[model samples]
Every structure is written in C-alpha cells, then in structure tokens.
Target: MRLKKRISPHSLRHSYATHCIEAGVNLADLQHFLGHQSILTTTRYTHLTQSNTDSAIVRINALMDSIHVDWGNVK
Candidate 1:
C-alpha cells in the first residue's frame, strides 16, 4: 500500500475553479457551483485575467445595446 499527499484541499479548490474558468464557465456560475453564499465571497476565491474582464464587459455592453436600455436613466 502506498499513500501520496502533495496537494491540499484548498489547492484542489483553486485548481477546480481555475480549470472551470479556463473552460469558459462564468464566475457567477462558478460561485453557485462552489456553494458560495455571495458573489463577493466567490470573487475572493478566483483570479481574473484582463481578457476575461474585457470579454465580459463587451458581452454585457452588447446585451445592453440589444435591450435598448440606458442604465443612467434607470432612476
């Protein structure tokens, strides 16, 4: 019998989230998958690349444009 222990639980969590993000899953979705109570809490658990943020912003802007809505006038 042999036992191996190189990675810890926290490391596994990080690897899981990183892999998921790299696979194109959204952060909000990941937060739910990880059972996080708040998006803020999940934000701390993962790192973001500039490309990811830029792409998200682009998609959000596109969506907003499609809706023909102006957030500035929401109030």
Candidate 2:
C-alpha cells in the first residue's frame, strides 16, 4: 500500500513523540527515546494539543474508577 502523501523522517519522529505523549508515556522516557539532551528541548518539540489533554483526562478517569474514588469529591 502507498501513502496518500510522502512524510519526511522528521515528521515521523514528531508524530511518534506526539503519540507517545498521548499514550501517557513519561516525559523523561520519551526524551531518552528521542535522544534529547535536555528535557526542555523535548518539551519544545512536543506540542500538547487538545487531543493530548483529552487523552490525559480519560486516563485519569480510568485510574480513579479503578481505585473506586469519586473524582468530584477530591479535595
């Protein structure tokens, strides 16, 4: 199968990093995977878009549910 359009290696790297962040991967681990010398550099490269926020919310909700905790009642 052929891609609809060509993607450069840098684009692929960016996508990988974004997906990893969305999947709740730790920033330090992601930095290691990307071979980034500084966490600040990794932060600049990864954009935490709305989808990433939504994914984080979902993960948090799942964790709360697993623990049988009421999210709204948190102090």
Best candidate per TM-score, number?
2
Model 2, 1-75: lDDT tens digits are 989988999888888888888788999999999999999988876897899888789989998777743676653
Clashes of 2: 0
RMSD of each: 7.1, 5.0
Off by over 4 Å in 1: 1-6, 49-75
- Over 1-75, each residue of candidate 1 has an lDDT whose tens digit, in order, gives 565867889889987987788678899999999999898887777787776789899999998777644676642
Pairs that collide, model 1? none
**Root-mean-square deviation of Cα positions for candidate 2 versus the true structure, in angstroms:** 5.0
TM-score of 1: 0.54
